[model samples]
Target: MALNDVEEAHVEDREGNRYFVYEHLAQGSPTVTNPTGKETYRHSLAATTVRPDRKGTPYLYTLNLSCRQDLWDDLQPLFKESIDSYRLVPTTSNYIAPDVRPWQFW
Candidate 1:
């Protein structure tokens, strides 16, 4: 689970919640070799929580964006916007989505 070329930074959401961000590249290998292999790409802007619980466990939470290298600049903003709009919710079974995205309740 090693991440290559790791770089870390900080980011903040509109409501003032701040997070630690990290960017890195990852490569995968198949259990069996094949004539055709998978391609690797750049992944970036992973924002996570810095503070852990009192138990000393790490509280890592992040959103990742993956796209064609050529489209990174074009699509990065949209991915960041979606990540910024994230809102935490209760894990109870009775929760429901707002009318805007009601189908999510299904």
Candidate 2:
């Protein structure tokens, strides 16, 4: 998908974990129409972070949210709250055994 009017920033959450955030606008297919008879468009927000797991393997974590462009102003605060609450829980199963191939495990 393509995004327009993109803005990006580096931010930290409440726990001081860093994240890269992107805010942009996305236009849906013109062939599809919403109930309002207008082409659909959305305000999209994405936040991503990379952190190591128990075995020191890094993984990318992302949070994405979208709302109708017209409702973005009203929903922005809620989206921020949700993103601020994001936390990574390190787990033992996050890594693969050195002797095993990824496909073999599945």
Candidate 3:
């Protein structure tokens, strides 16, 4: 699926790890209807990245938060906060994103 009207921004977690957040309007499958009988669109707020394994093959990772367009504006801030608060559990020792490569995984 193609993303429409995408907006991108950078956000940081409590521990100061930065992530790029992408917001867009995506066509919904099995479209939903509101109380008024009008079809509603889905809004996606997502953070994506590519991490490589020991062999160096990139793997995609994403955290997506979605809601109806009607609720997007009102809930955007809260969604952003929740996304920004994401903290990866330390692996072997401590959380680290030493090789933050620019990626577009939407």
**Every candidate's lDDT:** 0.54, 0.71, 0.65
Residue pairs in collision within model 3: none
Judging by TM-score, tell me the better candidate of 1 and 2: 2
RMSD of 3: 7.4
The TM-score of candidate 2 is 0.64
- The top-ranked prediction according to TM-score is 2
Candidates in order, TM-scores: namely 0.47, 0.64, 0.60
Clashes of 3: 0
lDDT of 2 by residue, 1-106 (tens): 4545675666766465777777778775443347553467888787888876556776677888998888999999999888767775544655554344545532
Residue-by-residue lDDT tens digits, candidate 3, 4-104: 55756665444544456787786555553554423556887888655555557655567889988888989999988877765554345332334454453
Could you give the candidate ranking by lDDT, starting with the highest?
2, 3, 1
RMSD of each candidate relative to the true structure: 8.0, 5.4, 7.4
> What TM-score does prediction 1 earn?
0.47
Model 2's alpha-carbon lDDT is: 0.71
For model 2 the local lDDT of residue 23 reads: 79
